[model samples]
Target: MPSKKDKGKAKATDAPPKEITQKDLEKLAKDVDKIASKVQHRQEKALAKGEPIKEKKIDPAKEAEMRKKIEAMVQALSNMEQTGAIKASGRKDMGDHKFWNTQPVLQHGEDVTEEGPIDPAVPRDQVQQEPYPLPKEFEWCEVDIQDDKQIIELYQLLTMNYVEDDDAQFRFDYSAPFLKWALQPPGWRKSWHVGVRVSSNKKLVAFISGIPAAVRSHKTLHHLTEINYLCVHKKLRSKRLAPVLIKEITRRSHLEGVFQAAYTGGIVLPTPIATCRYYHRSLNPKKLVECNFSRVPRNSTISAMVKKFKVAEQPSTPGLREMKPEDATQVRELLNKYLSKFDVAPVFETDDDVRHWLAPTPEVVWSYVVEDTKTHKITDFFSFYTLPSSVIGNDKHKSLNAAYMFYYAIDIPEKEAADSYDTARYTKQRLTELMRDALVLAKQADFDVFNALNLMDNSMFIDDLKFGPGDGYLNYYLYNWKCRDIKPHKVGLVML
Candidate 1:
């Protein structure tokens, strides 16, 4: 869902939108069309080469028809805060959310003075014992992810139809090992790996999944499921399969004793507890431009672009090294203590959970720590995970290897009790130092891009590290719970 996030979010149009003129909408359309066209052009060029690729762009009946769509999207979003009537890209507003309005999620424009679940919880015994009914031709299936054959089938389905860029130049290429690791975190339920299939042919076409997690919102701690990978075959999206997939996952999660859930999306729905912008630091600028992931700016040369993103060949942290099994205890204490400063975060109950999540998994995650050389005590830590994207039409580059910033912690004084102003500033400097090493490590690992969301203390180093804001925005939503809006820095949890 995060990768196929062309739906865009609030960075384009905020709630209670300001008055925008007809001229403003027209101008925005030109900018949007130009960005979309470049990526489309790159995809076609690759198709003519030897690599087999799907042709997504059709010759427009008239250029005006294409422009009309973009103009309509701009106008619709400009009026969204007041009217809640955006209908482009299969998205619906709060009032037009026929399916969502009936759910327990908070509605858009509802001034939230209290933070709690919108609906009362039902006993698990009272929950539905049967799966939601599907069309006669289709049926529900609980995928056994441990089985090799089934895993292959699920991988094939997603590889062909999962998250794709708007111009179709790139699609998420999640590996089988990654799926096994992400879906089988501590306390994961087999039933929560929900899927749909054609009954006769037994072909998997749609899927959604949830893993157990403990999330803290403001002052309250909750046992909730982290829902993700919600994908429906492209041809069947108009069939209203998305809502069904959501309902099925909720039902499965409820039976597993999870009453609340959290999810991230590229579009604004019902309401967002928090919204974060995606920032990308190019590790391989030349490959990114060739794959249409980024562009060489009008006034910039390739060498200039390359020079701007360069980092130290070696990390400067004195005692930094790869984290070991014994470091789990210190890391948990550090991460939990650090996360407590945020308004929303996860509450880790034990060090075993930390090892399960943060212990380095080769090819899946890379984590490192900074220890006090004199005392031999851990002082700070950082980590990132691998998630590569298929560069659809690039003849030379088959994949755009990306490293997504994950759980990281540093020593910082609480905002309320600061001994000196320089302490906070010093912490920012230390974070920049750690982050620069992360960039260098990502480059050493041969990643084409390093991405991070505007969450936690990321704002401190984002600009200083030369990361640029991306076209995408991820909206954080709490499934059954409701709360006041969460600002970026206040958001601590990062959903995969």
Candidate 2:
């Protein structure tokens, strides 16, 4: 999925693209350098005056006009470098979604009163037999993730070209171990790890991947394909390879007897079944401020900011400990029951699913469970994953460690009546306590910040825990599936 404000640009044009020459790219780079210098100077001036870190009042008309111009400039440059094909434009209408409009996705502003697949499933025999034709210079290949050399190749491609923040101040640094953990979940397939390479040199240049999962949209259960890690080399943007990669992946998924797919983007496409906002809880305030990941208040000092975000040294929740393999069964039962309350959620049908996803993996993921001190039964569980970002142009700090909230389940008391207010209130209070413990643990692990989306019951703790809203929005899309809008609280799905 795309991050805030880095959603690249408009959909690529199909017409033969006028090749962007090296000189053209250099000129664009120079223009961006000038803008960046000016912005940096402004930031230094603000810091000198102890400026407030809040939006300034501005005329609506002027703000809108100014925003449009900035977006255009950023989009044009980022399109060649961004990791996702999403855009952060103000225009609600689809702009040259020539390919998406033709696909089975819901049209922009289209109403959905019913839920089901937008396109009929095709038989395996009828699916495309050969891969989609890549440009003559490039050829398709199945990346052997198990192969160290191949995985490293994929890692290098992403490390250089993956997502960067709106200001280019930070870029996600997905470790090789982390990539393996994410792409090789239970029932993963080599065929789904699609990649493209230069035909002559066999150099991996572009990639897109899919993984099988049992996702339920309301009452309809679909064994859908979760699409992710769509990346194209920066130089190949004008080659119109993104659509081709998507089509190829779709074809391969169809051949595997899967039709429907789920993906997310930062931009508004034809339609989105749900839109979630991001929230950030700073752990290392001093580091965040120095990296430009955050800013201090007008009258605040770095030490004050740190004190404001500090957490207790120990967890308040009794019996909470690191999750173990044996806890998978109990955790699975509790998680499934909790997820059932959501309109859209994953179905962890087996204990292996629980262990594979929720069990802790050092430095990559962390999971903990609360137990009944005497009963020896699981009471609650929470999990988060590590995803550090490279701090661009920061001399003191080279990276910012970030922990992302993954999934959790708690023992909600039985409702006395339908829609019981007391039950909801209790749920909020308990979640707040557990999540605060999570923050403490993450801080102990030396993370600089914790990030989460406003899905599930997260809203209950966000404000109480001092999490500020972020500029990014993640739009959840179900390809070939039509479902009514799902409220953020009713969404239980989380994508890596």
Candidate 3:
């Protein structure tokens, strides 16, 4: 704008900035394409050689952050599964969470496992061995009333594992109650109570008890011993002790002039006599369900019936008469034939077992035999007994009461002639008729209740009898044995 040098300085200061053109933009694009192609070629070559692609290095701090996030996600999933908010897939589902989370994996069949910390209370080995040692000076003795302590101990030992079955009433713990009852004033005779003792220590570890039978209704006699409270210690079970006890009891029974002995167990060990069915009358439906006595049914009426029928009474029948002692031998023959139909029979075959079961007492057992007077032979026989009543909240009602329909037998004159006169069918018909007879006798005796156990096959007959169901049933287990086909029997009445 002025002189040549000044003008050039001014012009330089005022010069305009150059703008980017399409050509320059196209050149930059080409350079970017070249770089991308080189990167692609490198990646292809690396991939062909099975090498990971080259990546730009990331910050160690960022990598740690990313790792923590992934770990947290995994933990959340596990937590959800544990809380049942989510389910685990595959093999994890098969394992119990308590074992998986708390216990270490255990080796199969090993006595010990790494499942968490071992419980010090539990034994390392649980298998029991056989051939238990018996006391050197052990003597089998008849129970004398004076030997109250020994008798009490024997009862305690037998009832140690007394679990009331789903079908029993008036729960009995064999030991304590037996001791208390046996030692009451005018205590049970020592002869009726048989026990095995270590001669040195006089520790009464095993025993078998019996009570004499008496007359009941219908001119029938009961000459039998009711065997009960048989028990042995766990350590002494392998000593083959029960049969010895049985033989000793049988001897005592014969000494007492008894011919038959009756008892019950879950399994028919020692004897495989007649089998009985089971029926349960529930007291509390909810409680029964909780205790597994009865399952909750879909029909409320069935459930209500089981719950309410526990104390209901059946109508009494007539034509019953008191039993007589003179009828002993005839009753014996009838019972023998009755028992002979079954593969299992009671342990008492000798006069000993029979004598003990037949003696009269305040709590007398009675028998009634309906006879064909013209034929001068017995047609049917039923046995029952009286006990101090066990009805709750009624002190006045707790008097001598007749309970337990123990056993019954009917004569089948055409057994050999009639093809259909087998044990099962005959038993069913006889039992049905026996119910009618029982009702008649109950009414004549002015009894408020008559109870009978629906033993194994007898369940088929129970539904027909209109007998009220009971809340409890007896359970039996073998002391140290197994059986192939021991048929079960109904609960027969016996006097203690």
Choose the strongest candidate by lDDT: 2
Clashes of each: 0, 1, 48
* TM-score on alpha carbons, each prediction: 0.83, 0.83, 0.42
For residues 386-451, write the lDDT of model 3, one tens digit per residue.
432222223333222334455555667676326542444456656666665665555455543455
lDDT of 2: 0.79
* Candidate that would win on TM-score: 1
Per-residue lDDT of model 1, residues 293-320, tens digit only: 7789999987888988777788878898
Name the candidate, 1 or 3, with the larger lDDT value. Answer: 1
Backbone clash pairs in model 2 (N, Cα, C under 3 Å; residues 3+ apart or in different chains), count: 1
lDDT of each: 0.78, 0.79, 0.43
Model 2 ranges with Cα > 4 A deviation: 1-95, 415-419
Clashes in model 1: which pairs? Answer: none
lDDT, model 2, position 10: 29
For 1-496, candidate 2 gives per-residue lDDT tens digits of 1253334232343311336532454466346435543554464456458885243433323533443344333333334333334334422234568788789988876888787888898889999899888778889999998899999999999877777765667777888889898888889999999999999999999999999899899999989899988888888776678889999999999999998999987656667787776779999999889887778989999999989999999999999999999999999999998899998899998898889899999899999999999999998999999988877788898888999999999987666225554566578779999999999999999999999987888966887798875656677889998888876678899988
